[model samples]
Target: MTRLVVLSLCIGMVSAASVMSAASAAGPAPSGTAGMLFNHEHLNNGSPGWNETGVRLNYTLAPRHAFELAVARTERFDLRDRQLSALYVAPLSRELTGSLEANASSTHRVLARNAFGTTLQYEFAPAWLVHGGVKTTRYDTVRVNQALLMLEHYFSNFSWAVAWRPAHAFGTNANSAEVRASYYYGDKNTIGVILAGGKEAANIGNAVTLTDLRSAAVVGRHWLNREWALNYGIGSTRQGDFYVRNGMTLGVQYAF
Candidate 1:
């Protein structure tokens, strides 16, 4: 039953592409040379529940080139997890661009895991962008490989983006996908919906767990002034056989 539900959701995201409209959760950080975002998320999937806190920084070095740094900490039922990642983006030409990312994570169970990846993007037509990427992750003695594809389009009032990722670990294969659509209105208010789910394997405290994770929620953001904004969302997820209900997410952003 879990497998069937996940497959149906994946197909639905793809089919909606033909007729749906724009941007993603809160839309891209307003384009600028420097910016900061603070985020918080709470989720329960019939388990003890978890909360994640994160912050990200972005800097644009030159036209079409940027750098980003992010840090996150997660509170699980019994332990905590931490992660840090960096990304670099550069445009090769007017219609082509590329990005590279490196990540490291640690937890009470899995001492550490490292990942490196790259992505290529192309603007094939006006307001249409396509992207593909590959990533390799290494734990103490396990390696996981992932491949991804995404499509994004911008409309006059909204924007839409979808991504599919397939991963291989422990001699098994799993798939995941994400869908986002956001509409912009008023001076700086934006409303959006997000969905992410799939069946995958995860490493927790040196043990491997096969997880059936799924979540869907509606989110929105309101800009109070030129430098301050607020964001919030509500959602639920299913983790393994447990269900997390009424999950809440919130965030604040500052731009200079």
Candidate 2:
């Protein structure tokens, strides 16, 4: 599933790292730097429904350098019609860091889900980061290749994150874990309180399809100007035969 379509666009941007969280004074930009982000998701995993669109590009290849590219498209309203994901990110260092990325995907009956797999990343601080990869998939799977780890923290108003994925036949699993608490009085408003649960299993070579799931999510953010910003979130996923009633995301970002 193209690594689940880049992990479902990383669950709608993962709070955009708290909107870049201040600290912006590393001058020299204007040699062609740009920013754009748009995301939409409305999934009703009952019978036939899913409409997803994602577009991202943040560019600057100079002073301190930068580059990111993401493309996603999903349309399934009558079953069978999918062109999943594409991504590329590069920014080697400015502090303990590293990067390398690639992914080409399609799978959810649209077929063809394997052709690219190359990911290696490392980051030390600023909420630390790490990823080790190799993904290739098909039916009757019993370990195409897998090893993934993700951890995130933004403490203060409270935050927590977790991910441990092993895909052979769902041997090692815990694909998600999140705990959150938030509050921001005014001027860049934010009010939140959320609790999440996780577990996902996909047995290789589908016995048709096998998956166990769990979920819970609620988040919100607002700042009408200074380059535009508004975010809304809702979540629910209880899988047995797949069911996620309400999940939403709307975002905009620009700062150059």
Candidate 3:
């Protein structure tokens, strides 16, 4: 179903942690900096394929303060949908940071009508961080709410993270967990692997269903120069009693 497709997209993009971790790995960009990114992804489940194209713009207003806007178009099951999203991140303190994100889709037939999320991260010790977040998503026929907690550690050029998420939807509850490990290399370059498994609720043919899912992915970013970078990901997912999906993503970023 569409919920499974959304999960695939999350794996292909490596989730929000990818963005936050990459920023930590590369350190902060100068204030007044701006960047643009273009991304394309393709996914198949042994039948008709799904594709998504997206663009994102990011601007840094000051140290530890930034904003992002993005738009995406997706084609799946012979239907097309468009979504718009925005995010703001700021420092609550020297050791605490917070972010808020909201998104909406033009069509709710296959995507969520709207969603909002907020996260707070704190560094309690050198090279160690903890994050907590909550999100709510409204679909055409159902509303899902989720809470997440994550812990991360950095040493030398390597970083490791683990997260747990609990979700409620359609009067049912489910849980999932994920782990990621990344290595930083060169200037603003990183490579990482992610593994996740869990149960989730999905909308299927007018009925809400709870299903099991598992996914794995490898993602990376490489700087071609001071102003250009390439991002790539490849992954696969298994949706219980449904389908197996394999996908790849490629993107480019430019900064000024």
Candidate number of the best lDDT: 3
TM-score of each: 0.76, 0.24, 0.87
Predicted candidate 3 versus true structure: per-residue lDDT over 1-256, tens digit per residue = 0000011235412234434433333345534334333334343444456677888777766645677788888765566789998888887888778888899998855667898988887778987888888888888777888888989888877778898989998788889898878777875677878888898665432455667878898877777988887778788877677666677777777777
Q: TM-score for model 1? A: 0.76
**Which has the higher lDDT value, candidate number 1 or candidate number 2?**
1
lDDT value, residue 30 of candidate 1: 51
lDDT of 1 by residue, 71-165 (tens): 87766654677889787777788777778888788653442477888877777887787878888878777787878788987777777778898
Candidate 3 backbone collisions, by pair: none
- Model 1 misplaced regions, further than 4 Å: 1-47, 106-112, 204-206, 242-246
The number of the candidate with the highest TM-score is 3
Model 3 residue 218 CA deviation (Å) reads 0.2
Once model 3 is optimally superposed onto the true structure by TM-score, how far is the C-alpha of residue 132 displaced, in angstroms?
0.3
Residue 11 error, candidate 1, Å: 18
| CA lDDT scores, all candidates in order | 0.61, 0.42, 0.69
Clashes found in each candidate (C-alpha, N, C closer than 3 A): 12, 2, 0
Rank by lDDT, descending?
3, 1, 2
Candidate 2's C-alpha lDDT? 0.42
